[model samples]
Target chain A: MSGTESPAVAVRRGRPRDAARDRALLAATLAVLAESGYGGLTTAAVAARAGVSTATLYRRWSSKEALVLAASAAFAADLEQRPDTGTLEGDLRILLRDKAAGLTGESGRLMRALIGEAAHNVALAEALTAALIDPVRDRVAEAVRRAVARGEIAPLPDVDLVADLVIGPMVSRFLLTAHPSDTQDTQDARGTADRLLPFVLRAVGGQDASGDGGFA
Target chain B: MSGTESPAVAVRRGRPRDAARDRALLAATLAVLAESGYGGLTTAAVAARAGVSTATLYRRWSSKEALVLAASAAFAADLEQRPDTGTLEGDLRILLRDKAAGLTGESGRLMRALIGEAAHNVALAEALTAALIDPVRDRVAEAVRRAVARGEIAPLPDVDLVADLVIGPMVSRFLLTAHPSDTQDTQDARGTADRLLPFVLRAVGGQDASGDGGFA
Candidate 1:
């Protein structure tokens, strides 16, 4: 999948598909996801909302899961990008703060719904593990490797385990709290990141390299 | 809320409810939850499965959310009970292993569904926080207190933060991996606990107290 090619391009051959129409359908999916959640979302409703026939929607995406995956991927892709901030601590803080910010908007709504649906839908669950979770894990792993290479932190036993250590608390808090996308919850999540940062650094033996700041 | 009283008891006066019947209903609810998940669950379906009328189910529990919460709480209660293992490490290892064990079978299915449904249902979210999340957190906090008192670890920072650090990775891993409940995954999760334990001890300056062992 090239950056320019939409997910729909693979299914359709030479037929000229309207990019605007695809955007409309995906936007409708997001709206339906936010308004009614994944269980309540239907392709017919999305077609109606997007001012298109069900055929048009299906021609691009085969199932509701596919459409939702495509839409969620658009948002998660932005978060999957690796950050370069000279230091691992700086990069992590920025990544976490940006993540908290992302969880307070339309993208966050889609994510919350996707996560909910993934619990019951095996296909969606697998897709989520591959598309969203793996990417973030890979990005974090890359960051850790860079940190180790720069002598910012000592290498440890398992990179994946350490990556999980860094992101685990924030993800757990977010899932349990079920906070809506709002400024207050976003700030609260950021506060949680601040507290966890020190421990995460200490877990990896990055105390001196992290510039020696209190967890407060 | 008393040990002698069922949750259904206080809601209705001297109606002569059968505790056996309540157990059957909750069991049916779990069956439905495992088969249909929370979104597909209905009071009517639960009533049918329990061989009772909708009115009978409603008489004891006002809503589907309430019934599910009560059912989930029944299982979560078992997990909330404090384990006295003579040492913090022993307590933590047992707790983590037991928790991993619990995240399997019928209870795990219900938990996955409730967590999914709770994303959209505020009442379920709050009830989960109060019933399941809070109790486990409190138990951990109590464990930390005991450890500190026994001089196993010196406490300076927040207990809740430390608690989160301990449980967060496990929760996050479970959510992300969506691994099936088998001996392999259970063993893997326990291995994760073993790795995280020392870091947790180290985080609280318990490296010397934790009886040093290599993370490898």
Candidate 2:
């Protein structure tokens, strides 16, 4: 996913960093991003918001693109905290529900803008695909692997394809009608989980249809 | 989806419109849209592009939103012309393949931009959902109906939901990696159909696992 990976990254060693300052800057960056968009984001604005000097901001990240990517990386790391309900069905249900919650309100707007902007901006696009898409996809793969280990699903030729199958419907519908107030707004994450789980369950070859095997 | 619907529209009688002129205008609107984005589109530009007067443009569409909606309607109408390969599987393979073709190159850029812009612009979002989203969804529903009529599939509990299920994976994957030059660019529609068709067929309960029924 990181198509623009530099040789320096592989060989670079970490320097002692201020954890609290980094958190503050990232938080300020996310706030600005949520309010404006990627196009409107500036390192100066982020520094002002964080009460840090521009030089300090530049010390950690090179540019607005670099800062946004770091914030996205932090965001993605949070998304990797998956629910373990002892069954694939339950785990997926909770996972999808959590995803739904994230895709609403301000956070949803930020995500939509980031994904949309990725189409035009190559650097941001590659970074997002690397930090956001790949890790979360791997997390889903790990969940499926657990399901396979537990005999909840078959030993399929392609586990990643199955992950896409499970996530596609909810996300597709979500992206189409994610507005705050619309007549055909079907952004209800809980309800989406309810309607879509059966098909996913069946697709994975899960034996328990009764919602007992982690569905509830 | 048509949030702009009014009782007047239902009661009003149609004024005769020139079919060829309407086509030209819509074609021009799409051309300009593909070249530029929604933010860059203007009525004067569309009129000039179509070789029609600004008066003529306004005579048909009162505003830029109206013109874009009309063009979207034209796009949706073209999507409705799905190939009939004598079986649901064949029809869907062709259908998805055709969709994939549309999503590549210039047309793909237009589509991606439209979807992304819809998140910020409510009017465009509503018009697109009404003109583009609903009509194409109806087309999928029609395919399902035809399959049912041929006894190739069962009567679905909810045809629209099933349509979303069929389309979600392809569109989701398409939207994520839509750029022309990206390392993770998996925009091959034929390959997408090959991987995705089995799931769609299984979901709809098609008889022929072999591509002979309509897939080829």
Candidate 3:
């Protein structure tokens, strides 16, 4: 769901002015969301932040939910890039490292805000799956496909399960566990990736090319 | 922390009438939290729901955060009972299955509300680690210890990492992914546990005693 194909943009075709305005609005939405959270956010506040009229905001998105969903989708699209590091372990390290880094900053705040809102909002929950979880799932599948093609491991029966096994620990550590902000450093991410690599490789039935000989 | 050790209850020790009131207040807090989420909950509302005055609520819990944390801790203590099925896989299956079931009900709602609030509140986050995550980690460690004692597996280097590997996927599925409520059935929990057991065994350097081999 890119800008060009979005219904809001399609309805206002040939208007580069509105496209720029849309970006400002989305950015403003994210900013407001990060600061005030989903419950505290309002269309009027978003409009005020974007220097637009409430009428203009309403014309673009029907409700607060729609605006938040659109903003989240736009934001997630920007973070959807995945690396191809040849080996599965290499690919996972870069991807998870980036994820760890992301979870320590604004992206993390945005996620927590959205997740909090999504708990009571079914439509928002679906939007989150489409915007965030779906993209991650696609990236994991691609990584697994490359590994299989390169003969790193045999074809897996369930790539989704493999994805969960690979990505779950990082998510758990960042989201479910409590840690001081100072401790969430790049070195921590690298060490976590290093420790998890052998277990991941073993789970996927691939040999640990790192020669770490599994956890001691 | 249990009710007896809680400062709120400790101050009012030897008052049996207040102990029952405290339970009612904590239960009311959870009920309100489930319905209104962390953002929508108020000390006044919780007091009203428990048929108590704002003064009484303040006397017991100084603020909304304190009230929510107490309620959450008490609620979590009820769900902390772990199973012992002899084998590591067996114990995990039962535990994860119970977790899956819990995620579909009021416990899930409570957790989501807490997590949503935790993203913004460091105190809440730490409280959650103490109230929820720590207990689960303890249970996982106990299970691993039992397995080691039984010769089902060698000692692990990091039981916390092992715990993450085992529990993270299920949490990711229920919390992060969007699914229709009707589909969150017991069979699904069983199937998920079945699929994850092999990977968990492999990750912890234990043999898959269930004879399922690995993921097909």
Candidate 4:
């Protein structure tokens, strides 16, 4: 197979490609997206930033949307994990804190750019749903299921809507509202999550383990 | 004074610039923004589309940001009116339905584009908060006050947080989630508002006037 393989195929297959290179390329893609946004980003720019040839980029991903989708997916994958912290509020605090921490600097910028671009690009929109929205939804559903099973909450009528309710305020604060400074953003995120917990518990018909007596 | 007036000054002062002309120009700005996104919108293009001179546009608004701010404020103004429908659920339903209806075609596209642009532009971000976010917040606050006065809900600890909780899901659905067809979008909007009412009432400690028994 190596004897007649094309140079591009040989480079891809024969080279002992490490995970670091993939990480570098994806990071470069995210950086470019943050700096230039989706419309301004180019595969060439990403390749140049990553110190790789365009052929290397093409070998890994088919198009700009694919490259961005991969970057977004990797970023999202890091942010979502089902947490069982003994209580629903504890679980939510951990998850939301981690999510807020992750949604800073490059990751936040990449998300904003992708969301902006997705509005006009059908392929990007579908890719975003798969890469970003769906995973978060799954994670929230699992968390909700655990809470329900533990008798913390009644069965939710719509887990997806619950996910939206859980995530929406943060999204609104970060994306739709004015951009806060990084320090303020982090502080605000934590505070918002704390303030939001009771409402979320009530909304889900869950026991408020915080002992605040529900929405008092 | 009339004889010595500069041509520009005279044009500004003497021309019968009716509300219709202002509406036409703003409408033109929104149309261009919808079609081309914010990055692609130009004052020249708006003027051309509105069949007016660039000077006419410049005379009305100092810059592109000002022009867009005016257009966005006008658009938002039309969407936000405090509804007193006797119950919190009725008020929210009317508000959300009207908002969803307005967020179609040119308005939706313009919002997406503005959101995309505001990510990078500080002025646009500030303008967006003022034009879009503030009015909605005020309206939500008023509605919450009415609900409290009616003994429909407890006094919310944080009205702003309540506003975020109320609006976040819809914002997430329309802006961050995948786009549905227009018909499906309207139907989904209505369904979401319906489904969300119970949770919202529960969250706010409001009596569930819908008789759904609060998350059953």
Best by lDDT: 3
- Of candidate 3 chain B, the 10-residue stretch with the lowest lDDT total is B1-10
Worst 10 residues of 2 chain A by lDDT: A178-187
For model 4, what is the error of residue B26's alpha carbon versus the real structure, in angstroms, after optimal superposition? 0.4
Off by more than 4 A, model 2: A1-17, A53-55, A82-86, A181-187, A211-216, B1-18, B42-45, B52-62, B82-91, B143-159, B181-187, B204-208, B211-216
lDDT of each: 0.71, 0.68, 0.77, 0.74
TM-score of each: 0.83, 0.78, 0.83, 0.88
List the candidate numbers ranked by lDDT, top first.
3, 4, 1, 2
- Superposed Cα RMSD, model 2: 7.3
- Candidate 3, residues B86-144, lDDT tens digits: the string is 78888887777766766666677777777777866789999988987777788889998
Interface RMSD of 3: 2.2
Candidate 1 on B11-109: residue-level lDDT in tens?
Answer: 575444557678889989888987888878999999998998887788778898889989887767756668787787777766666655555545566
TM-score of model 3 vs. true structure: 0.83
lDDT measured at residue B196 in model 2 versus the true structure, 0 to 100: 69
List chain B TM-scores, each candidate.
Answer: 0.82, 0.75, 0.86, 0.86
Docking class of 1: acceptable
Best-fitting candidate, measured by DockQ?
4
Q: Report the lDDT tens digits of candidate 2 across residue range B4-119.
A: 55535623533233567789899999888877777788999999988988877886788998888789878877766756777887877776676565566566777766766776
lDDT by residue (A34-141, candidate 4, tens digit) is: 888888999999999999888778877888888988888887776667667877777766656655555554567767777777867777878788877777777778
Q: After superposition, which runs of candidate 3 have C-alpha atoms over 4 Å from their true positions? A: A1-14, A44-56, A155-158, A179-183, B1-14, B42-58, B82-84, B146-151, B179-183
Candidate 3 C-alpha lDDT tens digits along A23-133: 999999999998888988999999999999987787789999999999999998898788898888887766666666656556666777787677667899899989877
**Prediction RMSDs, each to the true structure:** 5.3, 7.3, 5.0, 3.3
Tens-digit lDDT track of model 4 for B54-165: 8777767889989998998888877767768888888776766655555544566677788778877778888888877777777778888898899877777767877777
